[model samples]
Target: MPAVDWRVTRLSRRRSTVTRAQVETVTGRALGLFGLVFGAQTVPIALVQADALLPGAGAALMAVLYGAIVGLAVATVTKVAVRTACLAFALLYALALVAWPFLVDDPAALHGAAPWLYYLCTVATTAAVVAVLPVWAAAYTIVVPAVYGVIRLLPSGGDAGPLLAVLDALYAVVLGVVVLVIVTMLRQTAGAVDAAQEAALERYDVAARLHANEIERVKVDALVHDSVLTTLLSAAAASTPEQQQLAARMARDAVQRLDEAGATGPRALDRVGLPVLVRRLRAALTTFTTPFTVRVVNAGGVELPVEAVEALYAAAVQAMVNSLQHADEPGLSTRRELRIRGVRAGGCVIEIADNGRGFAMDRVPAERLGLRVSIEERMANAGGMAHIESRIGHGTTVTVAWPQGAGGAA
Candidate 1:
């Protein structure tokens, strides 16, 4: 059968279905757009308040402010350096507010309904929601507005009434807090969804494996009854030379059939070049369901167990299946790597590793033959050793080495 060519193959990026990741991404973009709204109002406000500023110092500030706004706008779509852009915009806004008294040419000339910086507090506070922790977000919402409220009482701030100044400060804090609460709550809910989905997937994997085992068991039982038992009964009933000869031929044919059904025997095959094994292994990797970042290093010079390459390939496939089923860690992006290398002295090593939630060897149930018979035993039976190493939070690495403990990795 031909391997299915999935739309999302090895070359395609891993598209995460995890809700928490999606929520964070969409929220970041939303904040960017919100920043643009406040950013648009900045130009007119700056123009109206220009006469109140010191021409030289204020012109430089205006240039920096414009650059920061442009950065904030770009961060909306690209999502690259989003945190950096948000911090840059917020810091610039605070700096401008702090220097407002010195920047002004005269106190009365600064008269306006609201200071130029007031329009941008929404942008800064919203930006804080995405890039900062809850405590820092709270500080940004309160401290930035409080600074403006203090300035609102001074002549340089246009000397607004006490009631209006307090209200404006209160308004900024309320808006910031509301945004913070919404995002935080949504993130928590999404995280719970992700955990539940992973648990369901794990259960599905277990059920699928059990169903496959039952199918294999039925096949083996049929093979024994239809082939081996029939050959034995014929041999026992034989009395004449012709009948005996016929039984001998039937027995030989039945043994060949049993061999095809995976009966192990000491069979020697001519050693082939390492490149041959690599070509075979690489082709096998392409047929796997999960995409792995494959790296072929020093896959030349050495040759391994010739026909036994199939054993290595089978082990590799099993490892890939294990990674696909359970390597996704909550709140962390997953990455898988397949490394194939030819070492000194007719030896090779194949490693399948994942940066995901790992497991302790002692903790895994004994009945899970995936690690025992499929990977470890298969490799060992083929004159290779399979080493599995993992930590709870770190990750997992399965290494298949030929000529067990015999040669240095290339």
Candidate 2:
């Protein structure tokens, strides 16, 4: 057999418990009241008919006591407890139904009203059996009446024919079948509902996984365009010995980044600190071909993951290169500034601004991946963001920040 799903099992059990409780609550109250009235009515009748203390009279009284005790006990206990009491009472009542015929000294009493006291208790016991032990209910229903019919046909029993005995027995048996069908239908409906809920939850989990994978794919595409390809192009364009050496160093860094992306080991980014990161970036900037001013403010002791620091450093370098290659004008002096500041909220921001002629943001071609992939998407992939502010005559400012809320330094 296949292993059972614990979720479905739990749901079925919970629903069964609620259904069992409802059955017990309704049956307990109804049966308890019925037993009290039946006992009151029959005790007096038995006393009058027997005219003196007798076994038959005593059995009638015991039936009443059994019914009242079981009924009241079912009302007070939990569903499982009620079920146990119901089964036990059903067995005891069945035995009493069989023995009541033998206990009676008067044969006429069996045919007349005295037998009804036993019949009433038997019917009530059958109902309790139906509520708790649904599978065995039909058997008990048939057996209770069959045993009574057999005794009525015996020599000691009242002069009753076979046909009359069977007809009386069939009435309660039919009622038991109807109760069984209704309970079975309800259980099937509950199972269907639990199955539907489990399927819906599984679908939601699958959809969420697919959406996350799509997002990660977009980030990887942007990183490849921004870092690896850009470094290779710079190496191809180098003319002087110093420029070639710088390009080779950048190429090595780019390859190492790619290797780290594919590695399964623990990430280097998890151990990077802001102070050490800033010192390395400052050293790299000293080799830039174009002269620029660098300033650090409140950046000491701040730290971040390697991914965030790498994004900021790479984007800042691209911004500086853009200024050196594209911002210079023929007849005007230009000033470039790279500022790194640690915010009070516990993350660092790098602003690369140039006081040189700038281009319109909206007019930039889609093929120019320098700004889109290198600066904007790189920061986005690192769980941070980049903003570019520029105008035709004013200047361009590329601001990259890792917000405190985006898993920055603790």
lDDT string for model 2 (87-169, tens) is 55666666666766556666654444335444464445445554465656766666776776776565434556788767666
**Candidate 1 lDDT by residue in tens digits, 195-296:** 665454345334444554665567678978987888889889999999999889988887787777665433333344455455455556677666677666
Model 2 misplaced stretches (Cα beyond 4 Å): 1-77, 109-111, 121-135, 154-158, 205-410
TM-score of 2: 0.40
- Top candidate on lDDT is 1
Q: List the residue pairs that clash in candidate 2.
A: 269-306
Per-model TM-score versus the true fold: 0.57, 0.40
lDDT of 2 at 35: 51
User: What is the C-alpha local distance difference test score of each model?
Assistant: 0.74, 0.63
- Minimal lDDT window, size 10, model 2: 264-273
lDDT of 1 at 39: 67
Output the TM-score of candidate 1: 0.57
Residue 185 CA displacement from its true place in model 2, Å: 2.4
